[model samples]
Target: MHYLLRRLGFYLLAAWAALTINFFLPRLMPGDPASTLFARFKGKLDPAAIEALRATFGLTDAPLWRQYLTSLGHVLQGDLGVSIAYFPSPVAEVIGTGLGWTLFLAGSAVIVSFAIGTLLGVVAAWWRRGWADSWLPSTLIFVGAFPYFWLAMAALYVLGFTLGWFPLGHAYSDDAVPGWTWAFTADVLRHAALPMTTIVLVTLGGWLLTMRNTMISLLGSDYVNLARAKGLPSAQVALRYAARNALLPSVTGFGMALGFVLGGSLLTEIVFSYPGQGYLLVQAVRAQDYPLMQGIFLVITLAVLGTNWLVDLIYLWLDPRTRDAGS
Candidate 1:
């Protein structure tokens, strides 16, 4: 209980610090949001209009401290201000529109990749010197060496454009209505397949390699030897004794990956023109949409912190040492 409380407190403090930084970083940028918005209109708007735009964005020429306080209060109230990129639309609404797509795409990829890679790693390690160890990891890692966006481009061109095996972009087929219908769900999955494959291929090798090495190291540990000595089934010894312990490091990586899913795959989304948070973030940056950018960053930070805290709690359950130490 004490350990969980401490971790919670730490995350809260970290979130506060992240919020403060998110608030200031945009303000300290070379130009103000109003100026940027005005430039987008080719400066036809007068200086007085700029002030009005600033006021609309909740920007004030007040003291830095006062502005900070006001910003903090608004954030607490879930008022992320109007997005200049999406003029008159609140940041929350814009984010909410795209958040589901981002979650579905990135979240599915992370989880599936983790499960598949971890299983492969266990097999590769347990059957060391076999084909799985010698062949699979090397081939996958070789492909994984390419950047995610690079792979995304290749996949898009080959699978989407050249072969026409998948749709070119977007979350669903153009004609499909957005609803709970099987047709809409099938279209959504079809659109997601390429991007998800890109993410899985790019990330699978890391998890495979990490788990393989960890499992191999644990295979020779005293407890593993004891399990073998006890005449336990080979599968039980391998899984319950060796693979379970070896998975600890990957657990942390999985948690981080899960958290980052909320941020979406920026390059992959851009390459595929997927309508996720990453694409929205690009639009926000291009339009100098401070409120949108800040809201996205805040969401990402909170997600990461929240997932890490969850991982810590999992650690206490998975590893007895954590519980003992905490006690």
Candidate 2:
């Protein structure tokens, strides 16, 4: 309990710091959204329009501290200001449009890859020198050696463009209606398959290698030897004793991967034209959409911190040593 409280306090502090940074970083940049919009229009509007634009964007000539407090208050109210790239649209709404696609694409890929890779690692380590142990790691590493964008491009060209096995991009077909209907769901899955596969292929090797190394090291530990000597079932000893301890490092990695799910695979999204956060981020940067960018950054920061805190909680459950030490 004490341990979790301490961790919760730490995360709260980090989130506050993140919020502060998110507010100020964009202001420190070369130009504000109002100026960027004014430039785009070639200043044809009334000169006073720039001030109106600034005001709409929640920008002010007040002291930095005052502006910070106002921005913080707006953030707490879920108002991230109007986006420069998407004029008249609130930053929150723009992000809301893409957040679901990103979570479905990147989130699914992370969970699937983590499960498959961790299972493979456990199997390979439990049967050292066997077929899986000898073959799986090298093969995965070889495939994973290629960059994500490179693989995405290759897959897109071959499977999507040339072979026409999958749709070219986007979360669903243009004709597909957004709903709970099976047709829409299937279309969404079909569109997601290529990019999701690319992400999994790129990330699987790291998880597998980490788990395999940890499992192998744990297999020789005294606890494992004792479990074996006590005539425990081979599967039980391998899983309940060795694999559990080996999973700690992989859990940490999985948490980080899960957190970044909101960030999406940038290059993969670009190649596939997926309407996710990564593509949105590109649009934000290209248009100098400060509010939009800051909103995205804040979301990603909170995600990372939140997932890591969850991982810490899982650690307390999985390993008694942590609880004992905390006590």
CA RMSD per model (angstroms): 1.5, 1.2
In angstroms, give how far residue 61 of model 1 lies from its true place. 2.3
Off by over 4 Å in 2: none
lDDT of each: 0.91, 0.90
Q: Candidate 2 — worst ten consecutive residues by lDDT sum? A: 23-32
Model 1: lDDT of residue 240 = 97
Candidate 2 lDDT over residue span 17-77, tens digit each: 9999887777787777888899999969777999998888878798889888988999999
> Model 1, poorest ten-residue lDDT window?
53-62
Question: Taking the tens digit of each residue's C-alpha lDDT, what string does model 1 give over 1-327?
Answer: 898898899999999999899988887888888888889889789989999988867688888898889888988999888888998798999999878899999989999999999999999999999988999899989989997787899889998899999999999977788999988999999999999999999899999999999999999999999999999999999999999999999999999999998775898789989999999999998887888999999989998999999999999999999988877
- lDDT value for candidate 2? 0.90
lDDT, model 2, position 133: 91
Off by over 4 Å in 1: 42-49
Alpha-carbon error at 159 in model 2, in Å? Answer: 1.0
